[model samples]
Target: KLVDYWSDPDRMKQSYRNAVNKAKNKVTTHQGSKSFAQGRHEFVEMKAIQDESSAKTIPPMKDRGILDEVLKSINRYCTQEQFEDLKRQHALEIEEKRKAFESQQKVLKKFVNLFNRQQGTPSSQF
Candidate 1:
């Protein structure tokens, strides 16, 4: 039985792919309608978030089951110094992104102020 199951993994995978494709087509076809589009957008956004969470190298430390077990198993393969280096790298990336966003916000604010001042003219027909 185990051998049979292992041999037929491709068929199982194809079936799942077909089902997902059908669902995606349905969503895209219905997206022109306002309510359906909103619902579909929300569903897609949620799926993206789920995919991101699944792809993360670290899971929350509080869980005690399969996810946590898998994380622990992977951790066993890494040294403490290596893990610390990875953490530091991630922190630096986050800080750089934060700084870039703040700079963009400052530029946008200056543009808004300049536009407002340009429009702050007095009427000539007083």
Candidate 2:
């Protein structure tokens, strides 16, 4: 729907003008890392769409910086609640794996004990 709206020539021109005006009146102060990252991502996406629709190709946007910023934002956004949730999940997964391993070991031990008993050997060695 956004792409379709952007494809309209009259609307595209208006949008381009709006973008230029916005840039001219851009805010100086940072609006936190999350919003800043989101805004940059949206701006790059819009620029790419505009370039695709237009005849004249504009210089490619600096993608590496935006990507790095996004990664940093994600890392920074890991609040205590989210961190605790992740920690809980990790511990749960580890516990489940440990249980599975213990069960396998128990089964192997039982098999070895049964084999020893059949061969008339002591089961205590296993």
Candidate 3:
């Protein structure tokens, strides 16, 4: 019978408390690990985007025909004006992303500073 399992009130309370603590610990650990992994992934993606942008080298005007030929091959239906507009839009998007990333980095830095100050210890020291 179920009564046989929980015949003692004190034992039942202790068991309940133990179960609650275990659940809390599991949830806390899971959340902390998940947040750490997500932050790492975001950092890696941001760095890769920044690296690709920085490594871009604009070809000389004389060699620009190669770029045009490649673009033409891929977009035979697109007009020259449309292609130029596309390039402009792509550049604008990249610039906007860079600005947004910079803003996020600034906010993250401020949060980290406040967190460290509240904890009363430098993160590097830890």
Candidate 4:
């Protein structure tokens, strides 16, 4: 039904005008990221209206800095409770790594000692 409305030339032209006006406002910093995000959500909700293999389909744009941006954003926006939880989890992970390193070192030391004992000194030298 929505597509049928846009299929009309008059409605499509008006919609294009509204979109162009919004684009101009956005370029001039008169618009906010909120509306852009909402539009993205609407597009996704529309199921993109494309074929599985359509070359014309626009694949979702991915940010190369997404992980870094996410980490920064978390630092900026995380609540105290969330921050404490993350801090605790990070400490736990460090402790686990430390324990594993110590265990590996002990095993290596045991192996070296066993090897040296097996290569024992002669009775005359002892």
Q: Which candidate wins on lDDT?
A: 2
- Global fold similarity of model 1 (TM-score): 0.35
RMSD of 4: 16.6
Q: TM-score of every model?
A: 0.35, 0.41, 0.38, 0.36
**Stretches > 4 Å off in candidate 3:** 1-76, 123-126
- Of candidates 3 and 1, the better by TM-score: 3
For model 1, the stretches where C-alpha displacement exceeds 4 angstroms are: 1-76, 121-126
**How much lDDT does each candidate structure score?**
0.65, 0.72, 0.67, 0.63
* Candidate 1 lDDT by residue in tens digits, 1-126: 877875797978987898887787643444445575566666665555555567884452322233333324453466565679899999999999999999999999777777766888433422
* Residue lDDT tens for model 3, 19-50: 98777753233334456557466556555545
Clashing pairs in 3: none
Error of 1 at 38 (Å): 61
Model 2 lDDT per residue over 47-112, tens place: 565555464465444455434434445445665655798999999999999999999999999899
Give the per-residue Cα lDDT of candidate 3 at 88: 100
lDDT assessment of candidate 3: 0.67
Full ranking by lDDT: 2, 3, 1, 4
Q: Measured by TM-score, how close is model 3 to the native structure?
A: 0.38
Positional deviation of residue 43's Cα in model 3 after best superposition, in angstroms: 58
